[model samples]
Target: MLTGLNVAVIGGDARQLEVIRKLTELDAKLFLIGFDQLDHGFTGASKVKLDEVQFKEIDAIILPIPGTNHEGIIDTVFSNEEVKLTEDLVKSTPPHCVIYSGITNAYLDKIVQSTDRKLIQLFERDDVAIYNSIPTVEGTIMMVIQHTDITIHGSKIAVLGLGRVGMSVARTFSALGANVKVGARDTAHIARITEMGLTPFYLDAIQKEVEDIDVCINTIPHLIVTAQVISKMPAHTLIVDLASKPGGTDFRYAEKRGIKALLAPGLPGIVAPKTAGQIIANVLSQLLHDLVKERKGSSQ
Candidate 1:
C-alpha cells in the first residue's frame, strides 16, 4: 500500500484516470494537476493548481504518455490550463522524488538531469511495449479495414521494422491470410521474421518490396518511406505509420501521389483506453510500492 506516499499526477488523457484510480485505491495521496474540467473524482485524489502542490512532500510525479513537448509543455486533456514542467519544479521536489513518464524529450531530459532526479520512462519496458502492441495491432487492422476496399485476405502487406509493434503487426496481418513481408535492418530480426513463416526483406530493398503492397505499415521512427519509396507503391496502397509524432511516412509525397497515409502513434490509448490505463496503472503501482519499500529499508 502507498499509505503515506504523496503523488502528483500531472497532465494526461483518459488513461491517466486509471492510474489515478489505482494509486488512490492503494492509499496514495494524489494531487491531480490539470484536471479542472473533470467531473468525476477519485477517492483519495484532489485537483490542485501547479503552484499549489507542495513539491517537498511529493514522493512521485506522473506525466502523460507524450510526457512534454520540445518546450516542456504538457498535454492536458481535461483542463484548459497551459501546464509546463520546468527545472524549478523538479528542483523543488524532495531529493528522493522520482518522476514517471511514458516517454521523454530533450527538454524533459535536460530538466531531469539538471535536477538530478530519477526519470522512469514506462514505455521503455519490454512488458509495456509488448502489451501495448496488442491494441496497436487491433487499431491498425481497424484502420486498414475502414480505408481499404479490398479484404486483408491475400492482400500484399509490407511492415517496416521488426520492433515490438512491428512484429505484432506483421504476425497479425499474416495470420489474417495477408501476404505479409517484414523489412528489418538487423539480420537477427530478419531471421526471426523468416522463422515466423513471413517473408523477410532487408530494409535497403524497401522500394522493391513495397512496389505491389496493398498496405504498408511503418513502425520505424525515422523517415524510411520517402517520396522515392512511395513512388514505387501502387496508388491504391494504404500507409499506416505507427511511429511517434511526425511519423516516418512522407505525408506530402503520399498526398501528391493520391495515396492514403495515416500517422497513428498512441493507438493503445485511442483504441482501448481502459485496457491501456490498466496496464500502466498496474505497473506504476508496483513500482511505487517498491520505491516506498526501498526508501524505508535505506532509512533503517
Candidate 2:
C-alpha cells in the first residue's frame, strides 16, 4: 500500500483514469491537476491547480503519455485550463520526488536534469512496449479493414522495423494469412523474421518491396518511406505509419499518388484505453512499492 505516499497526477486522457484509480486504491494521497472538467472524482484524489499542489509533500509526479510539448505545455482533455510544466515547479518538489511519464522529449529531459529530479519514462521499458503492441496490432487491423476493399487473408503486407511493436504487428498480419514481409537493418532481426516464416528484406530495398504490397505498415520512426519509396507502391495500396507524430511515411507524396496513408501514434490509447491504462497502472504500482521499500531502507 502507498499508505502515506503523496502522488500528483497531471494532465492526461482516459488512460490516466486507471492510474488514478489504482493509486488511490493503494491509499496514496493524490493531488489531481488539470482535471477541472472531469465529471467524477476518486475517493483519495483531489483536483487542484498546479500552483496549489504541495510540491514538498509529493513523493511522485505522474505525467500524461504525451507528456509535455517542447514548450512544456501539457496536453489535457479534462480541463480547459492551460497548465505549463515549468522548471521552477519541478525544482520546488522534494529531493526524493520522482517524475513519471510514458515518454519524454529533449525539453522534458532538460527540465529533469536541471532540477536534479529522477524521471522515469515508462514506454522505454521492454514490458510496457511489448504489452502495448497488442492493442496496436488490433488497431492496425481495424484501420486496414475500414479503409481497404481487399481482405487481409491474401494481401501483400510490408512491415518496416522489427522492434517490439514491429514484431507484433508483423506476426499478427502473417497469422491472418497476409503475405507479410518485414524490413529490418539488423541481421538478427532479419533472421528472426525468416524463422517466423515471414519474408524479410533490407530497409534500403523498401521501394522495390512496396511495389505490389496491398498494405505498408511502417514502425520505423525515421523517414524510410520517402516520396521516392511511395512512388513505387500501387495506387490502391494503404499505408499505416505507426511511428510517433510526423510518421515515417511521406503523407504528401502518398496523397499525390492517390495512395491512402494514415499516421497512428497512440493506437493502444485510442482503441483500448482500459487495457492500456491497466498496463501502465500495474507497472506504476510495482514502481511505487519499490519506492516505498527504498524510502524505508534509506531512513534506517
Candidate 3:
C-alpha cells in the first residue's frame, strides 16, 4: 500500500475518475482538485480547491491527457472550472513531487524546467501507446461504419503517415478487406507498408492518390490533408483524423465540399473508459512501485 504518498489528481474527465479510483485502491491518499462537478465520488479520495498552498502538499500530481492549453490553462472538465497551471503552481510543488500528464505545452514545459520539477508524459510511454492503439483502432472502425454507406471490404482506403496509430489503422483496414494505401515520406515506412501487404505512395502524390478514396485516416499530427488534398477526394469519402485537436485534415474544405470528416481523438477513454483507465492504472502502479524501491535503495 502507498500509505504515506499523497497523489493530487487535478482537472480531468471520466478517464481520470478511473485513475483516481485505482489510486485509492492502491491505498494512496488522493486529493482530487477541481472535481466538484463530478456526480459520483470515490470512497477514499478527498476533493480540494486549486490554490497554490493546497497544491503544495501533493507529493505527486496527475494532469489530464492534454495537460494544458496554449494559454497554459488546465481545463477541469469535472468542475467546469479553468485553472491556470502557472509557474507558481510548479514552484510550489514539493521537491520530491513528480508530474504525470499525457501531453504538455510549451509554457508548461518551460515552467517545469525552470522549477526543476520532474514530468512524466504517459502518452510517450511505449506500453501505454501500444496498448491504447487497440481501442483507438476499434473506435476508428466503428466510426468508419457509422459515417459512411460503403462497406470496409473493397473500399479504397488511404492511411496517412506510418507511425504507431497509422500502422494500426492501415493493418486493421486491410484485414477488413480494404485496399489500403499508406502515404509516407520515409523510405523505411514505405518498405514496411509493402511488407505488410499494403501499397505505399509518397506524400508528393497524395493529392492525386486521394481521388477515389472511400476513407482516409490521418494519424499524422501535422496538416497533411490540405485544401488541395481534400479538393481531390470524392465528396462521398470519409476522413477519419485520429490526430490531436485541430487535427491533420482540412475540415474547412471538407465541410465546403459536403464531405464527411470526423476527428476522433482519445477514443480509448471515450469508447471504453473502464479499460482505458485500467491500462493507465496498471502502468501507474508499476511506476510508483519502482519509485518506492528507488527511494528505499537510495536511503539505504
Model 1 lDDT-worst window of ten = 204-213
Candidate 3 has an lDDT of 0.86
For candidate 2, the TM-score is: 0.99
Worst 10 residues of 3 by lDDT: 48-57
Report the C-alpha lDDT of model 2 over 23-71, residue by residue, as the tens digit: 9999999999999999998999999998898798899999999889999
Give lDDT tens digits, candidate 1, residues 1-300: 999999999999999999999999999999999999999988889999999999989999999999999999999999999999989999999999999999998999999899999999999999999999999999999999999999999999999999999999999999999999999999999899999999999999999889889999999998999999999999999999999988999999999999999999999999999999999999999999999998999899
Estimated TM-score for each candidate: 0.99, 0.99, 0.94
Q: What tens-digit string does per-residue lDDT give for candidate 3 at 70-171?
A: 888777878866777788777887777788888887877898999999999999998998888889999999999999898999999999999888888899
Q: Rate the local accuracy (lDDT) of all candidates.
A: 0.96, 0.94, 0.86
Give each model's clash number. 0, 0, 0
After superposition, candidate 3 runs with Cα above 4 Å error:
none
In model 1, the Cα lDDT at residue 2 comes to 94
Which candidate tops lDDT? Answer: 1
Could you tell me how far off, in angstroms, the CA of residue 210 lies in candidate 1 after the best superposition? 0.9
**Who is ahead in lDDT, 1 or 2?**
1
RMSD to the native, candidate 3? 1.7
